[model samples]
Target: MAAAAAMHISTEFINLKPNIWKKPDRASGSCCLGSDDISRKRKLPILLFDVMDTIVRDPFYHDVPAFFGMPMKELLECKHPMAWIEFEKGLIDEEELARKFFIDGRDFDLEGLKDCMRSGYSYLDGMQELLHTLAADDFEIHAFTNYPIWYNIIEDKLKLSAYLSWTFCSCISGKRKPDPDFYLEVVGHLGVEPCDCIFIDDRPTNVKCAIEIGMGGLCFQNAESLAKDLSHLGIDLSVPNI
Candidate 1:
């Protein structure tokens, strides 16, 4: 009976048998199944992508120091993390942070720094292409990032705004990654079930959190590998080069 039911339903909608294993309580009017099963059954839309180190390379490690006329070693030695932390908490304005990092006592031109951050930041190869392809296919693409100051700048400069439907940043949202609250807030704000969204991040902890919230997640390595992996999930990746 279970096999028959499983075969009858569309795999895209739900890939399980209803009442084959166990029936739900009369009050609920639905069988109790795992989130994975429920998500497939419900057929939700939405793909959540992590920004830093996933779509774009680590900007701080590569973009910031070089643009600010400081060596990577010097920038790393400076206590920027605490400032960033405060910025993420909404205690400091993004513009203020940028001013502190790139303007105050910095010999580099502010406009040049902005330009470098905008255009010089390297994105994962084929990422823009893949995202465009996905969006063209009617998949809603959202970017979730920990970086607050440069999110809009990078997106605008890279021409990613066209492909990305919306962007969620910890700086703007006042929520950091790897925290269930951040993911929950996003899912709730988007009015989608956790299972309906597929989250990709470079960090395992974030992926684990997504999974725990009943969302599909993949740990990203590179654009080529991620494209291949998404293929298994029925997402085609024939986007044109950006």
Candidate 2:
């Protein structure tokens, strides 16, 4: 498994299969990460938790669309199509992201936008306790999410690094979720087989990718639902108030 070492987020790029979401045929094999290179040893499964809606709700999802003077649906449908993914992949900085997003003549305040992205993150009640309990039980946990440069704000504000062995973001890895390379790289870095991991993400698509790679996956509805799924997976989580 990957050590709980100093967080080293690299900019290196390694290409793998592209993730096309429409009707994906699940790969049937040992792993999307070649089994020949993987260790045959069985290992305890690590929990890979997603951020944003999975842990911290994104304020920008609604606020940014409103700031652009459009409804959320319209904004998502016609807004800067590739900017968010590009931003998440670290291809462009925040200023560039804002510039790209506000291209439709909407006035953009960089600081105000930063505030929208940074503040009022409400962690699902008992989430911290669940993480602590999992840690106490000697379960390995890591933060895996698709977030942009401002991910640092939420990471610091929520103090996630204190609980997780490693926190990986698209901005840091330059590889977004649902991409096979992202999951493969994480497993490769940890020196573990894909089967030795269970992923929790808010999106079904993200979970699907992990499943295709032979990792157990759970779509997170809430912390309570997560507790139930973990219990089903034979992980005894003792989180009160959940």
Candidate that scores best on TM-score: 2
Native-to-model Cα distance after best TM-score fit, residue 110 in candidate 2, in Å: 1.4
- Residue 236, candidate 2: Cα error in Å is 0.4
lDDT of 2 by residue, 1-242 (tens): 00101113332312222222221112554333345333233225777899777877777666666655777666665556677778888999878876776437455787876776666566877777788788787677888888777777876788877678546778889998788999999888877667768888866767778978877888777788778778777786878987
Q: List the residue pairs that clash in candidate 2.
A: none
Where does model 2 exceed 4 Å of error? 1-43, 67-69
Best by lDDT: 2
Indicate the TM-score of model 1: 0.71
> How much lDDT does each candidate structure score?
0.64, 0.70
lDDT tens readout by residue for model 1, 1-242: 01111223333423211111112342453422345455445433577888777877655566667765678656645534455665655668756655554323344365765676666566788887788778778777888766656576776667667877546877778778777899989887776566557788876666767877777778787788778767766665765552
TM-score for each predicted model, relative to the true structure? 0.71, 0.78
**Stretch of 10 with least lDDT, candidate 2:** 1-10
